[model samples]
Target chain A: MGIYLPIAEISVNVFVLLAMGAAVGFLSGMFGVGGGFLITPLLIFYNIPPAIAVATGANQVIASSVSGVLSHMKRGTLDFKLGGVLLAGGIIGSTGGIYVFAFLRRLGQLDLFISLLYVVLLGTVGGLMLVESVNALRATRSGAAPVLKKSGQHNWIHRLPLKMRFRASKLFVSVIPVLGLGAGIGFLSSIMGVGGGFIMVPALIYLLKVPTNVVIGTSLFQIIFTSAYTTLVHATTNQTVDVVLAFLLMAGGVAGAQYGAKAGQRLRGEQLRALLALLVLAVAIRLAIDLFVTPPNLYSLSAADLN
Target chain B: MRAPNAFATAVVLSLLAATAPAKAQVPLTEGIQIGLSTDNVSITAGFSGADLTIFGSLENPDPLVARQGRYDVIVVLEGPPKPVVVRRKDRVLGVWVNLDSETFENVPVSYSVATTRPLQDITEPNSYKQLSLGASNLYMQPADAGDSPATIEEFTAALRSRKAATGLYSENVGGVQFLSQNLFRATVRLAPNVPVGTHKARAFLFKSGVFIKESSAQLEIRKSGFEQSIFRVAHNYSFLYGIFAISLAMLTGWLGRVIFRKD
Candidate 1:
């Protein structure tokens, strides 16, 4: 069955949307990454208008991330102080990102820019994860322990002034780099229509040396806020948020995330990471191919009033 | 009875000529009149596409003017005008980028034309240009003044090709089939993406390479049902709609979690 989306002004199969949402949500729950990076590209490939896809994709991220955050809340793994600082930066970065989006859209370069941004982000993140997971998996199969990077080491970030203590993560670090990292991720995710969880989880672990348990939950906490802000900004400014499409996706996404979190517990960390790496790589490779290959038709039309 | 009717029409024509001086250019509809299959179209939530049929009838008051079924009728449907921006891409650094662009204001968002025969077969090129009566021939008003003629031509061609490619603009020769002696019908398919507003449906009567009579009708295409309400809310109360959208997302999330709790 299909329904018409008023904001997108297109009729689409509701089942297809639900399936996509479920698939993305499952992957996100298993890997602890927001699925906007997957959903936005898939929508674009399906010929949905890029603006509508991006805006509605952000809305879906909010739904899945909220569910993820709630589940983590009961476990007491989230660092609210750290998440608060990140959210403060995200709000500022998202505001700036919307203006940049408007400028690029006015120049008719938004599609090209969005595609290029995805190619770089997914390519780098996917490439790093693939190499690291492969090594970790091999070490595990050989009955060898993989040596993790030393945590809580005195890094350059500690030298900055205005140090603050994060009781949950048990770290005392300057807030400057933390805020800047959060802002940069927020800017990228908002413009790319993601939740910044992929970048946030890794950055928190490596850059801030936040505990692995704290990273996933705290990242999701910030994502819920950032994605929600991005959705509202796109809706008010661009009027591209398709509430009908968002709801349909969220319906399958939230349910899928619940089951996926359960399924993740059955797999080893190395195997799960390996699988997530493969999934992210697949999306990255697809986007790269689209950029490199010649399109069948070139000319396109846009209207001032359209999103 | 024929003599009395002709005399009365002449008297009425004289009176009209004295009262309406500006309408002297268009002759009184002495040849053809058009009636649409339906003038008002409501695009409900389930609307995918619709066919607009124009049924035109030709009448010859003067026996000497014997055109028979040779009269070619071309019906053109032009949607409401909106500003459209088109960007042309070029290969730069082995990647395609939008290097040049043009914006055309007051351009019909959708234009569809159907005719009894080929456009060239029915009228002179001069009249075709003067009337601007075909899908490809719609006049484009360039938003920028400094653009050269070459750029204007390029932009106009790009606009026509893009709109035609999307089925928003089209032309089909022999689309208007004559059912009988003086009756004809033309069907124009309005794609689902057709701009939602009043569309001008113009029917032109051409006989022996001369424009004889023309009549224009308005067909309204507007959103209805659930779709209408959503579209209105988004455009009218955008901020409120945004908040509502977020709230909806959160609600669905919470509900999904509650329903599917493993514990």
Candidate 2:
């Protein structure tokens, strides 16, 4: 079925959009991520204007993050204090990012900047995850115990001033790093339309030394609000959010997520990580190729006004 | 009846000549007029592209010239004018980037033409240019006239070709047909992505390859449906719309978790 997207001002196939959402949702559920990183680029590839794709992608992330946060809340693994601090920083960072986004759009350089950011970030993150997972897999195959980082070990981050205790995670960390991390993710969320979970999870685990059990939940908690804020800003300032398009994706995504979670339980931890790493690498590589390749049409037209 | 009609025409012609004796041998000048059934057209969400047929007539066409197929009509439907920027991408450090741009003011968003015959066969190119008729003949004014002429020409050609490729600017040969000696019908195309605004429908009359008269009418094209309403709300009440979008997302998320809980 065909449906018109009001904000995008384009007619797209309903089934194609639904299927795209389902596929991304399935991956997000299997890998325990918000799926925004994948959806925004996919929308661009599907011919949605990059501006609309980024804004609508942020809107879609809210549903998935809320769903993930609910499960964490039930398990009592969420760290509300940490999430709150991160949110404080996120709002500020997201505000700045929105201004930058608008400026680049007016300069007609937003598309290039977005693709470059995706390729660099996704490529590095995916590369690191793949190597780590593969090493763990080899250790298990060779009948050796996997090496683990001791939770008691102290890092330079712990030495920062003005430390605050997070009771739920059983840790005392500096407010500076926490706020800065939140701000960084918030910036990425608004500009790239991602939850920044792929980066946030690892940063929490390694840099902040946050407990593994509480990391995902806390990350998701902050992600929900950050993406919600991003969506609202993009809607009010740019008027680029296409609710019709976002709704269809959410419907398919939510259904696919449930089944994906069940399927994920059947896979080993290292194997699951390895698969997700490969998927991330694939997206990054595809975007990188587009940057280097020649486009069919070099000349394009737009309204004189940014709208 | 024919004899009396001819005599009355001669008497009127003589009276007209006596009043303005500069040219005494000429008959009444041919004039064209077109009419529309409605002043506005509302297109629903499912609107793709459609052919709009306009009915018109010649007021004083000579029967002998009409019989010989010398009277030709060219009808055009011109969309609302808007300022547009054309950008060109250049390869820089192995990445394509938008490097140069040109802006044009008051350029027609779309132009669709319907002619009784091919444009060249109906009249001289100079006449088309003088009348500023047809998509090619329509002048596009640059916002910065100080720019190099070569660069302006390049961008202008690019703009027209892009418009043509997108079906916004089109030409339909033989789309206009004479129903009777003085009556005619013209069909122009409206593209799927047609801009919503006031469109001008113009008819040009030609007698034996000479421009005679021109007439025009106005039509308001508007989008009307559920989608259009949403668009209006998003732009007019943006803050409320943003809140609504956020609320909808949250609702969907909460509902999905409850309905499809795996644990």
Candidate 3:
């Protein structure tokens, strides 16, 4: 029942790992999320080192995003022009993030830093999303269609330079905002192991006003390359990515996502958003508590002490 | 970057130190027959912890030393070396954070010692230091040894306690039990978390507190089957391995869509 992870150098139960992958996959399917945020924290909670957890989580994201993108491609929904611009920034940002990751690891503050970063990021993102989704749900219940952000609305993003036309999304917005958004997500991808869908899909819908139909596909496309780059960086530089652990997770994740995609059709947009908001908030709350709570083992030992 | 392991460091140092040879003394490897239960240990997925029994015989020909009970047998096992970093956590804004740290380079990843009797009772301080009989007597130099404010004593204490806690570095004073007048066997416990590499097991024979012969054998602990292939690919060809991982994931993702179909 136990499988040894070659890179992680530990033995974990195969069934338990599969079940965990299924649980996270189910959430991703239900909420249109990558579940990296959930899985990485769970791995860390189980005593897997933060470095390995983050790297392997990114590896899984590459799998999830690839399949998600393929389905979108079949439907001809991806905005390749838009995805390309973002990917250019993403690659650059991720490469830079790895150096920062290596530096923090050497100083032995990577673990604490990762936890605090998650607490802050998840708290802010989850809190804002929950408030917005709750109000949108309330509007739907009152027999009013929740209003979607309209295109061509003048904003700060519109005023930026380096304008480019994205034919598929039918947007002529400036490339600056797209690049910045891509860079931010790419930076987070290496450190946090997320596909950045939770952040990206929402940004495309509101900030860039991309068509909702194409937003998910475009985000997945960008995620595929970004996380793949992150995986390579971690493997070559930090030597932290565990291929065996990633393989087990992807096996369960790919299968579970099929069921998840089918289940997603049953819910209304606002209802689904509401559920996702609640789930994100719950994870954020858990992280917050861990930060404030006194850890059982304050002193951690690392490196080697053979003699 | 994945730092070079302790074995690599030791080999380089030993080669350099050999050129500037130390004091001439009786080499420790006199009349001893030693065997490990399995010289090459294969670590499969089912590997937890293992017990390594070092069975050896000593040819104690000197009758006077045996009559006086001045003969002892010490068996030691050492894993490949790597740097160890120990840090003290301080409360910063109510969240614990690592502040000060000391790094000890070229220390064994794991070291286990078993002897017929207590190490201290068998040898004097000068003799023990020269032989490196005890764990504390290792030549583990702190990176900041000569620097101000970073004491060697503090770093070594942290290193010793931490390794002891993990069962990596241990000492069994009476672990080496004798089956007969010239035969002895000792069991050294290795934790599951022990690093995988070439380990060294050494046995020393002493008489009347003078230097004697020592015999050493190699113990190869490597990942077996699929784990072996995976470990080699990851560490050896990491860049290609990364690409392979991504490709495999993408392939599975695509295969999933093909098999499951749109429901």
Cα interface RMSD of each candidate: 2.0, 1.4, 2.6
State in Å the error of residue A250, model 2.
0.6
Candidate 2's DockQ is 0.70
> Whose lDDT is higher: candidate 1's or candidate 3's?
1
Q: Proportion of native contacts in model 1?
A: 0.75
- The residue-by-residue lDDT of candidate 2 on A1-307, one tens digit each, is 7887888877789999999988988888888899999999999999999999999999999998888899999999999999999999899899999999999988888899999999999999999999999999999999999888976899888999999999998989899999999999999999999989999999999999899999999999999999999999999999999899999988888777777877899999999999999999999999999988998889898888724
User: Ten residues in a row with the worst lDDT in model 3 chain A?
Assistant: A298-307
Question: For model 2, how does the per-residue alpha-carbon lDDT over B86-113 read when each residue is reduced to its tens digit?
Answer: 9999999999999999999988999999
Clashing residue pairs found in predicted model 1: none
Give the Cα error of residue B204 in candidate 1, in Å.
1.3
**Candidate 3, A244-306: lDDT as tens digits:** 898888888877887887787898877787788777878878877776777664556678433
Candidate 1 residue A173 C-alpha distance from true site, Å: 1.4
Error of 2 at B245 (Å): 0.6
User: Which candidate leads the pack in DockQ?
Assistant: 2
Chain A TM-scores, all candidates?
0.96, 0.98, 0.96
lDDT of 1 by residue, B50-134 (tens): 7788888777532223235457789888899999887888788888788888888889988888898888888888898888888
What TM-score does candidate 2 reach? 0.95
Model 2 ranges off by over 4 Å: B1-27
Interface RMSD of 1: 2.0
The model with the greater DockQ, 1 or 2, is 2
